[model samples]
Target chain A: MNGYLLAGTITGVVVGLVIAAVAMTFTKKNRKEKFTYDERQKTARGEGYKYAFFTLVIYNAAYGIIDMSLTKPWTENMTGMMIGVCLAILVHVVYCIWHECYFSMNEEPVKVLAFFGIISVINVIIAVIQGLHGELIENGMLTNNCANLIVAVMFGVILFALAVKGYVKKEAAEEEE
Target chain B: MKNLKLKAARAAMDLSQQELAGRVGVSRQTINAIEKGDYNPTINLCIAICRVLGKTLDELFWEE
Candidate 1:
């Protein structure tokens, strides 16, 4: 019921919407109007969804157990939930990227990569600002600001995986040639 | 169980994996995976590939 927490949530939602709009704009400009995944990519993405679903389920169960056992949990309920969501997203993204199914046939990966990079940078900046303001943690438990950091880390890991996979594919093609 | 027959047919047609994949509306990696035995595509895709190469299913996909 804290006014500051409500305000922070609103701000986060607004920022997220703005970033999504920007990403969509870039996608519209660079990609085909009809986005589609090939059959193999679709199959791979289905597996990714399965793994990500299990990840979220397991994370939520563990979080529930830990929260119940502790008198004071390390994060708010919403923040803990967000962490699980981020973990699921990371798993799905990494799996899809590894299997060469993350980007659809008509999707411009450069635009998607740029969007992720921008999101990571923005979340990191927000987390740092909140940390400086002594809002990242309160009473020895991580606050919602920690969720921003977790999201940044999630996107960062995705970006790194994408880069590494791209490099490996390029090297493989060269060797084959 | 690499699809050597498919690869041979594709090569005889002078088509790169990417070119064949495009004609079949799939990604190059999918074609590579098929030829490398890393992926077993669906019947629809197999038919599509066969149709593109002007080969029958038995010619490209049958294993003796």
Candidate 2:
């Protein structure tokens, strides 16, 4: 890599870390009003965690086996690990959403949904830019640039699930009325 | 079996599931699940519901 590019990357990462730290501090300050899950929701969340853990274990095992058996790995280490983590997160989110335990007492669903929407859009844009640059794949193998694409897809799936669940509930409510 | 007694009690109080759940510090979905026989809440939650609805354990949650 060019020396100037390496320096610029390092500088950008450092600035990003500072911004993230500031955001965390602001969030912590605003979170003084704590929201808690009720018993049933807590139990459902626990089950979600269990399922997510199992997903992570199963995904990692399969990924490891595939990587070892293949002559060339499809993904780099960071990307492969991120895929597993995202899968686990997707499972957990879907389970919690299905069980109606995803949102706590004081949390606004619209805000959470908007947050996910923004994250999905940002990731999708980054992935698209990388794809256009021919960075998402190299030598017939998936590159680390695909990580953003995977994240975009994960959030997209979550948004889709939430929408579907909301639609189902609306239909059920209309039927009951 | 569905806890029709709990549903009746909640209804008698003129409280919607959302209102009752708010009073009992739970989600409406939890109350709906309990009423629908889909979820068996903990004893604490049952007690909370009973207290909110002015019912006893035997009145609301006990199997007939």
Return the top candidate by DockQ: 2
lDDT of 2 by residue, B1-64 (tens): 8889999999998999999998988888999999989999989989999888888999998896
- In candidate 1, the residue pairs with backbone N, CA or C atoms under 3 Å apart (3 or more residues apart, or in different chains) clash, namely none
Candidate 2 DockQ score? 0.84
Each model's TM-score for chain A is: 0.91, 0.84
lDDT per residue, candidate 1, A1-177, as tens digits?
499888978988898899877676676534446667898899999999999999999999999999999998888778888989989999999999999998877767888998899889988998889899998889988777687899889999999999999999999889977
Error of 2 at A31 (Å): 4.9
Per TM-score, the best of the predicted structures is: 1
Q: TM per model? A: 0.91, 0.87
Model 1 chain A scores worst on lDDT over the 10 consecutive residues at A25-34
Tens digit per residue, CA lDDT, model 2, A1-177:
567646755774586478556543433324665667888889999999999999999999999999999999998776788799989999999999988999887666876777678768988998999999998889988876686799889989999999999999999889977
Best by lDDT: 1
Q: How far off is residue B6 in model 1, in Å?
A: 2.2
* Poorest lDDT segment (10 consecutive residues) of candidate 2 chain A: A21-30
